[model samples]
Target: MTHALVDSQSLPAELRPYLDGLVRRTLAVCGRHLVSVFAVGSIALQDYRHGRSDVDVTVVADPLIPARALRELAESLAHPALPCPAAGLELVVYGADFVGRPCGAAGYLMDLNTGPMLPNRVSFDPADSADFWYVIDRSIAHQAGRLLYGTAVRQVLAASSERDLYAAMQASVREHAGGEGHLGDNRVLNGCRTVAFCRTGRWLAKREAAQMIATSEQEFRPLIETALHSFQHPRSEALPLPSNDVRTFLAWVGERVDEAATHAGIGDPGSGTYPDG
Candidate 1:
């Protein structure tokens, strides 16, 4: 049982070999249980930066795949085994039954984070506390995911509800506000993306959304520019981001999302327990 990988022609030349290796390795590990493979995030959105971005991939496997097979698959795809072209690979394998389901309801079988920029983690629990990010990523996938192999994206993935997206946005903003993660540039750009999505009902690339926000939000232009510069030149010596200002910007964006959600009658912002990653 072999499946042809598709849609690599539109990807950057440097990424083709890496993606080919991923698909081939995945097929070899999962064998007949593999259903579909989707390239999401930076690669899918055409915003990939050689040294900055991670290759975000989502694989849908038959629910019957054995635990041993998943462990083998994870080991095979870990950084050193199959070198990643980008910073790392963020791979999540979900059961076929979970692909088209709603956010909270769709639990993944394996969430493997491997790369230079990220700490390696291999989780098989469906009840993992990182649903906040996973849910948002799934929503993005529904919009811009590129099918690298197996079935078409739309056939296996479903779009997230406006309310769920709004909630996830709020959770993300709250997490950043509480100083949970680093990478100040990513923090600023993520705030921009969240606000843009809330207003336009579309997911824009991090830099695209930051650029869009910069044009209209004059006060935040400097901060947005700083983020853009750091993202574009990941290897360059960069000044630490101003923590106070970043928090302010995120709070402001959270307010905007809240306002939009209220106007649309999207229910309580605190209605669900969305633990941050």
Candidate 2:
């Protein structure tokens, strides 16, 4: 099976081959049941950081594949032998019919966050997994994502309205924001991007989203810079975590989301899950 999707040069030198293998293996395991696979999120945008990013993938299924088979596929992919290279393999496997249906569709078969290959641990949740990635992911996959196999994303996804897009972003901020969850690197970047997507239709990666917040938006610069630093150089010597700044920025985004909702004429969003993909 072919592995190359987007230009290899766009990503970090060390990380590309691993992703290639991942796409190849995914296609093999899914077989006929796999309608298509699209590499979404940061890697899709060529903005992945070797040590900090996830190999975000979306697997589209046309038929209702049995759960046992899917679990077995996950086991093989997450097996200690063939480990993931990034922080983890963040994969969302769902039906093709649900591509753009906002009211929710057939629950996902697998929402996996398989940890790094070394220890080979995995987090698999196949519950009614619907969230922000729907509209936003479709937009990304169609516009910039790498098609690993099957039909192109454009055909799989229907047109998205501005309100639908706003709802997705708003949910991302609302759900992931509250949790007494400290503003870690992931939170900072995601928070910024959630706000950015609400303002502008463009869905940028965390790094670029952080930039959008920093340069254009004056309020979140300190938090965005700190988060960006944490993302780029997590192991940098003597790097202080911007604890207060992160919390403050998150709260600020919550308010901005309210404005976005009012401005868009949509009510308070309910499915605000963190934008893991």
In terms of lDDT, the best-performing candidate is 1
At residue 178, candidate 2 shows an lDDT of: 54
Q: Which stretches of candidate 2 lie over 4 Å from their true place?
A: 1-13, 103-106, 117-130, 133-139, 159-164, 179-183, 235-240, 271-277
lDDT of 2 by residue, 73-137 (tens): 67766734456666667777777777645432224667666765333433345344445665676
Displacement of the residue 70 alpha carbon in candidate 1, Å: 0.6
The TM-score of candidate 1 is 0.93
For model 2, where is the 10-residue window of minimal lDDT?
Answer: 117-126
Candidate 1 regions exceeding 4 Å error are: 1-4, 235-238, 271-277
Position 37, candidate 1: lDDT: 95
Q: Model 1, 1-277: lDDT tens per residue?
A: 3335696678878788888889999999999999999898998778998888889999999999999999999999998788887888999999888877776433889999997767788999967655678878898888999889998888888777777777777878888776665578888899999888877888899999999999999999999999898887764344468888888888788788778888889865545332222
| Residue 14 miss distance in model 1 (angstroms) | 1.7
RMSD of 2: 4.4
